[model samples]
Target: MKGWKNPILLVLGIGVSNIGNWIYFVAINLLVLKLTGSAAAIAGLFIIRPLAILFTNTWAGSVIDRVNKRRLMVYIDILRGILIAIIPFFNSIVPIYIIMFLTNIAGAFFGPTSETYITKLVPPEKRKRFNSIFSFATSGAMLVGPSVSGVLIMYGSINTSIYINAVTFFFCALAIFFLPDVDEKLSSEKVRERITMKTIAEDWKAVISFGKTATGFMIIFLMFQFITLISFSLDSQEVTFIQQVIGLSEKNYGLLVSLTGAGYVAGSLAVSALANRLSIRMLLGMGSFLSVTGYLMFYLASPQTIPLAVVGFIIIGFFSPFSFTGYATFFQNNVPVDLMGRFSSSFAFFQAMVQILLTLLLGYIAEVVTLQTVTVAFSAIGLLLAAALMSLIFLQSKKALFILEAENNLTEEG
Candidate 1:
């Protein structure tokens, strides 16, 4: 609590930036739809996001540890703000897609950089609480952002909504500008290391070596990556699923999304309120189970019960605090702050690679097969994956218990 100045400001900036993102998230798709009238184009944007990450994340992580996080964030925010602002003026699809892709490339730098900054600023003891609060604030923004965007589009224009998003990004930059520097010890050698393909490869090699030494950490990391990979794959098709199969309008889709955001807020607040009593196992394992179950429900949803999608989304949203916040704390506690950037960004690189391949494949599949069938198949597969992950967690726990018991016995004999 004493040295919370940096973390607080950082979280504030993150929340502001997230609000802007959610605000424009749907609007951007609608903009593309208006231009091309192709759901495939919308899904194509999802692919672009991961492709940008794959192109940037490895080098971004390698260099992040050598740089000033605050300055980097501010610069990227300004760049993204400018890019987003100009997006409204672009009448051609090619220019719009290019701008969006570049904006995401800039954003790739911000995400890992911000995560590493938070790890440095926030104390391990308070990390979980801070993340819960951060997530809660972000979710609050999610609840209101799309609604605001929708209303602005209804009363004003999509261009106006996009401009609002642009403003928020600048606001975020301003907010972060005042934060005291939160950084780790930057190596002289690191500053000299230029960004290159070799740099990424070397960093990944180091990450692999580090993970090998800590089997438990490696397992948890893989779990996180796999879950995200599965989720993002579905995300590429989610909007299409909502509109076509579920028979919902754009406004109703936003409404149901807001409901899920409300659930996220509730879940985060509950975790924050009960931080003292909750154990990581209960939070991570049980949380995964519940979140996955909610996803399963959505995957199995029918048009007759389309209205019930909100309930499933809410349930999934409700448990995110446990899975996301728990993993954040887990990583902070286990990984070195010096290597945090590399560990995070390298993992993201892998996740992006997985998402890129899977999203393209799934997108192709969705074109030929019914979108609903694809949705349910993937959702059902996600459920099975969750079950397998839980088994891994169970085995890891048993292994730890056995090691602890052996240690105790050895101590007693001595």
Candidate 2:
């Protein structure tokens, strides 16, 4: 318990912020709809996030690595809080979109900075357990956040939920403020490098060089990211598939989402309890394979087989946390903290580009082809990727990469 103090606080802060984000998501959508009465406007909101990532991540890593991450995180949180707080005052959709994009830019910075900070704060041996706990916190927030937002909107107004989200950001900032500055010992002189185009170009080259040298790690990382993107594309079309193709009512669709959230909560609990017993190899391999299988099942189910779809949702919701915990721990363990920001941001830039293109392509294809056909094809692709991921995970040559500590190699071989 004594050793868990910082991790606990960190998880709490993250959990709070996640809940606020969900609340803001619901409120902002409602606010937009109320203002413009356009579903397309809400859809446009989705595009802003990746666009913000593309705009910021190209150079965000250079700043992330050169600054004190903890202080940077605190400042970003405060900035986001201020931005979100003022969103309700805007009656125009364009201004709201602009502000949302800026807020997302701050969020883009917060992610890698926090990841680097977590690596610095948590020891290698404890990272698996810490990440499992973090997943549970995230799952809880997913379940509670929208429900809380719904109640607030019912009792008060959308502005109330938005303001509450801003409050949560401030709360998160306060929580992060108490955390130790892990980079305090590093000389200020070492971190004061100028952020010229030459420096940024050199950083990109270094990240690419690292990827070339660490092919195994890059393969696993990119594969998992592709799988996630497929899932996202499917999710973007979920409502239409459920309502139009499956002939389900909106009420039933909401029920299905709730059940999926319940499954996530259950899975997070299981991961937290079994963190000590499960190996990273098993977590990554089995978790990804099983989760993709669930997606495949969901994609194949028809109106007459709603139960099958329900089961699929449960399986995916339950198992995804396992994959997430494994991958996050693996990333932190393998990547040198000094280079993590650059590696994460650089790949994230490429990912944003791919995401925008893939999402638009899928949406276009779904209109031309049947949604069923498009979904089935992409999910099948995910299945293949999962198999490839599992093969990579189980390879004997890569066993050393997953070990939590240098001395723990003996345990993973079994």
What are the models' TM-scores? Answer: 0.86, 0.96
What clash count goes with each model? 0, 0
Lowest lDDT sum, 10 consecutive residues, model 1, at 405-414
lDDT of 2 by residue, 275-361 (tens): 878877778788999989888888888989988899989999999999988888878877889999988898888899988888788
Residue-pair clash count for candidate 2: 0
Leading candidate by lDDT = 2
lDDT of 1 by residue, 1-414 (tens): 676777787788778888889889978989999999997888687778888988887677788877878888899999999999999888788999999999999988888888878877776667767878887887788887877888988999998889988998998899888987765455667677687778778878888888888777676668766776777788767678888888889988777777777889899999888765675556666677778777767766778997567778889889988877767766666677778888888778778787778877788888989887777777777777767766666566646521111121131100
Stretches of candidate 1 exceeding 4 Å from the true structure:
184-189, 196-198, 236-255, 303-310, 360-377, 394-414
Candidate 2 deviation (Cα RMSD): 1.8
Q: Cα RMSD (Å) between model 1 and the true structure?
A: 4.6
Best by TM-score: 2
